[model samples]
Structures are given as C-alpha cells and as structure tokens.
Target: MSRTVVFIHGLWIHSVAWQPWQELFAGKGYETHAPGWPGDKDTVAETRLHSEGAGVGVDEITDSYAKFIAGLDSPPIVVGHSFGGLIAQKLLDAGLATAAVAISPAPIKGIKILPLSLLRSSFPVLSRPGNRNKVVPLTEKQFAYGFGNALPPAESAELYERIAIPSPGRPLFEASSANFTKNAPTAVDTTRAGRGPLLLLAADEDHTVPAAVVAAAYRLYASSRARTDIIKYDDRGHSAAFDHGWRQLADDSLAWLDRQSL
Candidate 1:
C-alpha cells in the first residue's frame, strides 16, 4: 500500500489551497491528504470569515495535526509551506512523518538577515496597536516585496488576489521574540524524534524565507542521519506554490519522496 502525503498549508490558507499540488501528486501514484488548521474553514471564503481573532496558535495547529496524524494507520509523509513548513518540521520532530518537505519554511534557528523589506511586509498585522483583532490585507507594494518581489506583474497579481486573509499576530509576535527563548516554552518544537528524510525547498528569490533563514534551519537539524537539501529557484517568489513554474517544486518533491521509497 502507498503511504499518505499529509499537507499542511501556511498562514492565510486552507487545505483547498493545496489542490494543485495534490492533483499533481496523486497522478504520480501517491495518495494525498491536506488537513485544515484548528480554526481554518473548508474554503477560502470561510477562512476569510474566520478573522484574526479566531486564528490558531502554533501549538494548537501542531497538536491538532498531531491528533489527526496519530490516527493514521501508518505514518504519512508530510509537506508544508512557509509557516506550514515549520509545522511540518514539528511533525517530523514528533516522529509522525515518514519523510518531510518544507517549502520556504520560515525562521527556526534564526537565519541571519536584516532585510527591511521582509520585516515590513509582515508589519501590517504583526506590529499592531492594542489588542485589535482584524485581518489586515497587504497592499500591492507590500505583496510584491514580501511575497512576489521577483515575479512579474501578472503572476504577482494572481497571488495577491489569492491572499485570502491575514495571519494571527501572536504567532508572528512570538516568533519574533528575543532569540525564541522567551517563547520557546510556548512555541512549537521543530526538533523531535523521527526527523525523517527532510527536504528544504528554498526559493532563491523568496523574500520571506530568504536563503539565510532556510540555510539556518537546515543546519540545526537534530537528527543524526537527516537528509536536508536546499533547492533554489531563480524566478520563483515567496508565493512559490502559486508561481507559474510551481510544477518544478512539485516534481522535485515527488522525485525526492520517491527516492525515500515512500
């Protein structure tokens, strides 16, 4: 029997966002399962309706996913994007995944990069005033810098259109802590047992998860025999999953997973 491919989407998206990847993967003799986060709805519209106040914490999302993964008859191979990539790492650490893929996974061991553009992109919602709970949409310029700086106008616009909702400020706030020490007790763990064959897909032009950040996470793998490879894309932006050449990421993932005999 074939192992299941469990997909965990990043912030601002639901399970349906992974449809394209799922369709492509299923065609290659693989089974696919993308589960929703704690407060994520079944569809994009509903996800938008969920609002910022209803957002799930990193642990909530991870633990909820853990329950779903645990019930599986066999450990499913896991894949994630951006924040979802971090979640994927957590799952792998927990020994839940057979193998894992992290596409533009955000900072874990603090990759060194002080790009103001990347920091400002998340500023809209991350550094809010008071306990304001609302989803703040990113401006066109913000979208371009934060997610699609390297992509053309048409591709960037399509991605901006799909920017369903804003992520919760708490995750970002905690993630931006003073060396994660202040938040480590509350944050999700990316260092766990099964840390299976791990693949880190780093987009070369990605503004959010820059080369430095991805490289840093790969370096801190607690696993002894962990296989981590960083695959760079010339024109792909932070919104790589929706980019025109997204097929390459999917194909590379399929090939890597195939190599693991999963």
Candidate 2:
C-alpha cells in the first residue's frame, strides 16, 4: 500500500493552505490529506465568518487528530506547521505516526526561555486572560510581523487576505504557561526512545516561532535514543510552510524521510 501522509496546519492559517504540499506528496506516490482542526469550517471565508474553533485547546486538537489517525489504514507520516508542529511531535511520541516533520512548532512543556519576539507574537491573545475562551484574530499589521515578516509587503498582505482566520486562543494560553503547569496540554514525551524519526524545521526570520525556540526544542530530545534532527532555513519566517520558499522545505522533508527509510 502507498504510504499515507497527513498535513496539520497551525494557528491563523487554514488547512487548505496545505493543498500544494498535499499535491506534491501525492505526486511522489504518497496518499495525502490536509484535514482542518476540529470545528474548522470547510473554507477560509466560511471559517472567518464563524469562529467555530473558539476555545479549542491543545489537547483537544491533538486528540482529534489522534482519533483520525486511528481510523486510517496505517499510521501515516505527519507534517505540521506552527502549533500543528507540536501536534506532529505529540503523535510521533505516542507511536501514532511512522515519521513526522514539525515546522516552527509551538513551544511545549519544559521549554523555559521565552524569546521577546515570541512574547510579542503571542501578546495578541495572551494580553487578555479572557481570550482563553474566545477566538482571536490577528490584525494585518500583526500578521505581517508574526507570520510574514520575511515576505514582501504585498505578498504578505495577499496571504493574509487569502488564508488568515480567527483561531482559538486557548492553545496559546496553554503553551504560555506550560513551564509552570502540571499535566499541561502542551506537554510532550521528549524522551520516548522507540518513537519514529522526527524532523524539526526552523526559519531564521520567523518572529512567531523563532529559530532559537526550535533549537531549544531539539535539545529536549537529547535523551531520546530515537532519531531526532533539526534544520534551519535562512531568511525565512513561520510562513516557510506556505511562502514562496515552501517547496525547498517540503523537498528537504522528503529527503529526510528517504534517509530514514520511512
């Protein structure tokens, strides 16, 4: 059977953004699907009109995907971006995926250092405690700084108009307090020795999930006997998953999968 691949998108961007990546993997002889998070509408415009994902938290999103995978023919390779990246890691740790790629994943429990830029990128939601139960939307200016900092102004604006949507604030709040919370939703098994190979991708210019944050996450896996690797993309931002340079990142992931013989 052809190996299956699942694409998971992080906050703000819609799952439809993974269309290109899905097609790319399919052309490579892999079955692919990019399902939206629970409560996500069928399209970007519809999702924006009604924030159905409001109040959804980290664990809920992870469990939703986990359930989806359980029904699949086999545990598929997972490719996730932003918060989706964190989910990818969780799935790999739980032995629900054959291999995984996390691009600019949100910080998990045990990540101590919080970069200034990360704080600023998250401030929109974390600025208000009540946001934990509300859906929050980023302004164009905010999106420009957080997700599209490395793109040209027009390109960034265009992407914002196309895919940006209100996202549940609870995940951001959960990740923010992960370092101090017990049984936090953002927690992941960093030391699982028998998990499948995992790849962490970071973009140097990403203000949302700084490359240093990803580096810190990679260090957390030092105790794992399983394969864990990280790659940094120069002059890219969190949008590297959908930006002009996304193909390079996607191809690199495929290359890593090949190397791992997955």
Query: How much is the lDDT of residue 182 in candidate 1?
Result: 58
Q: Can you tell me which runs of candidate 2 are displaced by over 4 Å?
A: none
Model 1 TM-score on a 0 to 1 scale: 0.87
Per-residue lDDT of 172-208 in model 1, one digit per residue for the tens?
A: 5546662746545223344443357789888777777
lDDT of 2: 0.92
Per-residue lDDT tens digits for candidate 2, residues 1-262, read 2289999999999998998898989899999988898889999999998868878999999999999998899999999999999999999889999999999999989988788999999999999999999889999999999999999999999999988999999999999888889899888899888889999999999999999999999999999999999999899998889988889999999888888865
RMSD of each: 2.7, 1.0
lDDT of 1 at 132: 30
lDDT of 1 at 131: 20
Report the lDDT of model 1 for residue 7.
90
